[model samples]
Target: MKINIVNPDLNELGYVIAIANIKDKHDTSAPSDYHWKILKCRMIIFSNSSILACPDKNDVKQVHIIFNKAGDDYDKLISLFVKFSLIQNGGIRSATPEIYQKCFHYTMTARIAPVWNTLQDNYLINNRDFLVTRGPQEAVKYCIVVNDTFTVIEVNAVKINLMLTEEEFLPGEWIRVLPSLNKAIVEDSYKDFSQGSKFKSYKNLRRHWKNIHGYRLPENESAYYSIQFWRGEPLLYPKQCVLRNFPIVIPTSQPLEKLIISRFVTCLTSKMANVLGTKLIFKLEDIQPEDSKSLAPKDCLLETQAVSLCTPTQYSRSQK
Candidate 1:
């Protein structure tokens, strides 16, 4: 969705102001999936003189904003510098000159508008722990249950994949695990086989299966049925709910290749989406940080020191 604000009253605000036309497509279809609809908006204000636009990013608050936007080019440049310094130094602690300079560099080279206000910060903090579904299947990876000992038990094959490996094998992530069930099983066994092996007896294997291995069919519980809206009607279907109560997963019949690419891209903007607390979209304009204030730190000296000295040096040391 795109919103165009044409010829906003510059006399009153002296700048063109326009609202992005936001459409809640989900509401039109799946009304319950999302509570609000958001869209990307762009405000282009061209004054007789060069309009200075400065953006500030605060780390403590994790918010970005544009401070002042009406000045000469030189002043605008300075304002941009200051805006960057503010964002890089908005935190409670002071930053190093080097850190402030780095922030300035980022601002000077910025291609997109910074988010305004502390809303971005809140969104980041809150959605940091969100369950994002990105595979072609969009199926729930597993069900999580905590034992009395506080140990978590994941209850699905996909969950096993995620926990056992760093490579993200989301529910729908496609891999050629033999198409035929029997063929797949034989391939899996061969893939796991090593050059030398012991315990070849069927009884020994059965003992291993009984004592060290677990075998069971997927659960067919009705509660596992996920409800989705089609047009104006509700449809009950199978879905994967993460171990956590939040972030329900629904599988798609699409091919695996397409799903994987789309999901990876979605992860990149997750930071922006969570920061803005708006639905995720490719449009960076929709992500507003909630006003102009540097959330990083005010003082550059301390910020640099913290990064160079205060923070853990394990990575640097390891490199050495």
Candidate 2:
């Protein structure tokens, strides 16, 4: 358990708002597993209000703003705020090389869990001026501080969010600490919670997650993705998705049969990716009749089988 030797050079980068661990999803089995695994240098991004975050380049490439000050990237910054305001902590499965180029996320350390707060706060937590200051552990020694421009509303929101985090849930829903029994299991594993946590298996955890907390664990992979991308309703595509009512997006547009075998890897695997070079996704609004096939209807696309529209592909296997 060795923390990053090289600290992030804050000379040109923005203040450190968050930090990521440098380990695989399956790395954690002990409390101290996180500290040493964190690489600080990778997080030192050159941005306006960038927060220190993400140890792996594959997890997060650049930084987003943290304050409410009027800047060119106000919306962008607030969006980050919104993102953390409602993020998932536990996950369904594991995927290698998580980033944008990949798809989905199945990490144990997904958000401000009690274990997360303990590990991170062990590094440090103090408000030099206002609400709260959580920079690198060096922030305190260097007499550093958190953002100063937080409004009363923002400060209250932060307090509320923190409270919710303490309770072990994300914002806009519920947040709090789990029972000691549950926490015992949750903080242990970084991946593969389905292995059975003191917290419980997927069935038990999912049940407690919903019944006790009043929130719902995504049963549908697309809904899981929905929870991943935006903490809103899942935007499931009929064919691409695997849920009876939701979508299950893969890393790549893989075959229907493959989804079950790979357990989500080998293509659109269960992963979190930071980079997807030059590919962008835009949420279409009022789609018109003139849209392309790519812009499939958002509504449950239903129609009677018109004909055998099947056509053989150029692939040798398809011809057979």
Model 2 alpha-carbon drift over 4 Å, by segment: 1-17, 21-57, 60-67, 71-195, 198-285, 292-294, 297-302, 305-320
lDDT of 1 by residue, 1-320 (tens): 01111211122112111122123232222122111111010011111122212112211112222222323433443354343222232322322223333322222212111111001111110121111223212211211122222112121111101111223223322221100100000111111212122334323322322221111112332122112121232222112211211111222233542343233234434422321112322321121334112222122112122211012112110111
lDDT of 2 at 185: 11
Q: Write the per-residue lDDT of candidate 2 for residues 278-305, one digit (tens) a residue.
A: 1112121222344322222233122332
Listed in order, each prediction's TM-score against the native is: 0.16, 0.20
Q: How much lDDT does each candidate structure score?
A: 0.21, 0.21
Cα miss at 142, model 2 (Å)? 46
